[model samples]
Target: MPAHVPDLTALTLLVAVARTTSLAEAARELDLSVQAASARIRSVERRLGAPVLQRGRQGRRSSRLTARGALLVEWAGPVLDAARDLDAAVTALRPPQPDADPVVLAVAPTVAEHLLPGWLVHLRAGPGGEVALLGGDATLDDPAGDPAGAVRDGAAAVGVVETGTALAGLHATTVATDDLVLVVSPGHPWAGGPGVDAAELAATPQITRRPGGGARGALADALAEAVPGVAPAAPVCELATDAAVRAAVRADAGPAVLPRLAVAADLATGALTEVAVHGLQTRREFRAVWPEGTSLRGTARDLLRIATGGRLR
Candidate 1:
């Protein structure tokens, strides 16, 4: 091994660029200026003797990782994981700080926004008192496809994900159930009317969550089974958060299929109306997950108990 190794800071920046596919965006995240990010990237490329990013056209779009960059990112993932673990291990050796916050949770957008606030209140008022929630993306920004990954990577003590099956490396306990409802603005024709035909609903383009989201995946699977060989139109717009999708639908961008819990307030306020789909089943399971074989203790155990209503699976 060379005495001079590539700086982890630069490697971290590379991974950020790969995930975001934008030099400026990655730089912003790393708290570095664009010029500094570019310089760091060039330095890394020189060290590796290969370009890591394919810059997009100026003023047009963002840059993306090249094939070599993808490989570099793959190599960097484990390095970063190890670094995080090392930091955690060191932190664990310190004396416990009485004022340290409660266990962190990683949760889906719907759970974070609609369910957690009330749940936390209940938890605090009960056996688990005055618990603090951290890292659930409560603002509905930067939603994670697998919140359980946060638990697996030790970033969170537990995760609440909307899925029937347990994610690999985690044990899941069913906590709640949610239905995905087709919603439209009050002025839309579907509002206060008979249910939409399954075929028509499948054919219509609507505002939706980005691909690979649990809600989007559930809807896609239902449509596939309901109308085989018929594909739904591409979404009118794909938003990352339920809140964003709701906003788009409220603006009359198009009808949307969303978790009922996410739009409960809007439905009550008449800001949105549910349009039943005759033959589509939109119900989904919500589960609390923790890393397999790990015994829950203290706040984590208390949280799981509260989330599952004292039912353990």
Candidate 2:
């Protein structure tokens, strides 16, 4: 016998083979393919240092259990029975159904306005109570409205943020990605022109989000990396939200870097034009973050699953 006993799966497969007297039938009963079942038995035999089944010279048709295999099957019966009992006990101890607690979601403005609404629609179509939504500019200058901060402070059960900053003390997973584009009104001088380079963009005064917002920070970082030793010029106008900044840009306030999702409609409708910025990359990730040391249960986990298209658990 192996020092460590074979796992439950191997033992169960052996028992199935003995009961059915056909390896192929045993695999079908266990929902395993024939090849997988064969490999599993081979693994068990290697661990036991003996053959479990004797195959006829013809093929799998005349296979039979070896004497050692018969003995293992007998010993494995009690173990499998005990495992079933343990499973029943554990199932009884668990809650009968999923928890139905109210879920609160704190979301960044861009994600809330652009991506989260559709996610919420799908979430609401299923089993859940009213989900309190807190959406705003989660900037360093404004912690009160910071989505990640809300999760860290226990004010919200989950948060969605789009930023390059590492969220300390929270478990974060990427759900989607977005790019920021420089946009100007169709009537602006730079509109429909051959895009500007990073240095030119860095030196130009334009409408921007108020200092410390995620989009502003992303643009600044990209510009700094593209043009070393250079900082972005002061904004001609600084606004607190992407919507306000977009409105300003639409009114010919000046060129502003904004999320593509936020401007896709306006660009499609000819209300705004996207200006290409050469040598400047502004792609950012959208993340679902929750407090560390706490597993997401109930509706919170459901919402995350929806946001990630059922990928995360």
Candidate 3:
């Protein structure tokens, strides 16, 4: 090791930059100017032989852990965490304090795409707080996909996991519900359906959502009860994004069953149509999940209380 090894402050800044991905975002979270925060990171990287971040691209600084840099981050994260853990333990020995880790809520594609904006606008406007999010539309914003698990593991303070299939053993509260309606392109005859029937769905080149999947489950449940031997054939397209499914339906690829919340504006503007099913009106509830034994106070609880209308116990 060199005589001038990086100091603890430099190491902490590096870890923060690594966790946040962007220098500007890290600065915002840490309450520093982008330039000053970045300078600290560069100073640390300069002590190492390789670059730890690629700076000044697209007006944003993105990090790249070089081969040696990767080795250093891997070795350093636990060491830094342990030191902090020791400090926290010592602090805990003295007194109890607020435990808000600044929650990151994970939602399904439809919820994130459609429902999140209003909730987020509410979170930002009212909570004397800020929230950093990972994942949008089911793609991992962070390398680890389970943001709710992050709460359980203490990486995040809270998160919301959306699933039609039950998530057992977590403290969960139901939040809202939306319909999973059969969607078709504006040009389809079912677009102005007097009423869609099981036979009509059977004859069409349908785009069925798979069972146990978020938006798909409602449709799958309806079909299971309506047609005794109906097994959904392979979809013309399989997609994880509501935008993709909506686009596919618009391109006349096939009928897609999706949340009404996701396509509400489209349905109102006549960009798409919800086919009226004679015997099916599929729906599902959205549940807010937190780790077992999680406690809330002040801003986190206030935002949750506002979102759920004060029912969270």
Candidate 4:
């Protein structure tokens, strides 16, 4: 609250600990030792005259945040978000170098489809920066559960995930998000009109996203809840790529569940349509996943700003 206050560093460290819910995670994120992070928190709390967080159990989980701490988090989050945006804007105007490390972006194929094309074009033409982008097999259940050495082995600088489970060892920042839709071929009656219930959609032919992949089974899982043990039936074809799935639908493939962003172009062109599922559309989250050992770089930050498509929640 003081104008001349130093050590926003400690404040951020405390914030990181609260966000990550573990001292080890906070230390890894802050590039500090667990012991050192613990000491810093202790020192700050002593000075503040109140504990900021309660260590749950033997300290593996943080059980609570004091009222004062809650107020700080609420106040600080938006400020930090804005500050990061300002930093990104400045980075965008700078001329890039030939020798700069290529920004590695791991993304979901659907996001890579619409946003990536335009975003990359903007980056190269505008930033004139060298960069490399990567995508995982969406057919694969979860990238986090992939080869332990994969992030290290691939030397991946960042990973993008589409789920609720928090990926350990990465600084996760959210980007674009969309509702999951039940996709149908142009010829399908439901494709032309209003949304249908989950039960009806389940009974009809369904082209599920690859089983176990990101949010592929979300609708089916929801369906199973209402009618125990009833999984949404699969369509004749099981395509992996977003573009391919749209093409399949155009060719009269079964209705598929896809992120609205993934099928925006198709729907606009009348190539594919969504039949409403009774329940609410699945809320899908798209996040930028970065390795903890590496902090955010100026260029990467700019890329993120542009990639957000001017959308952030």
User: Quick one: best lDDT, which candidate?
Assistant: 2
lDDT of each: 0.77, 0.79, 0.64, 0.62
What TM-score fits each model? 0.59, 0.60, 0.56, 0.55
* TM-score quality measure for candidate 4: 0.55
Q: Candidate 4: where is the Cα deviation over 4 Å?
A: 1-100, 134-154, 191-194, 208-228, 292-294, 309-313
lDDT of 1 by residue, 199-227 (tens): 99988998988765537878888899888
lDDT of 3 by residue, 1-313 (tens): 5654676666766666667766677777767787888787777777885677764657454665446655666768766754554443233223223574444555544555565555555555466455445543333322325645766676555566555566655677766777777788889867775867775675556654333344665566677777657775667766656777788888888888778887876788788888787776476777666667656766667657766876686
lDDT of 3 at 154: 61
> lDDT tens string, model 4, 1-313?
6642225666777678667766688788889997887777777667767777775568642525667666666666755654444444345334446676766666555555445555655565566565564433332454323321235456555555565557777666677677877777777877567677767766766655565443465565666765565655556666556667777777775677777877876788777776766665477677776666676665676667676765422
lDDT of 2 by residue, 58-86 (tens): 75533389998899999989778656644
- Top TM-score: which candidate number? 2
Residue 169, candidate 2: alpha-carbon lDDT: 97
Cα distance off (Å), candidate 1, residue 311? 3.2
Q: Which stretches in model 1 have alpha-carbon errors above 4 Å? A: 1-101, 126-143, 166-169, 212-214
Query: How does model 1 score by TM-score?
Result: 0.59
Model 3 segments beyond 4 Å from truth?
A: 1-101, 134-156, 161-168, 199-203, 207-214
Clash count in backbone of candidate 1: 0
* Best-first order by lDDT: 2, 1, 3, 4
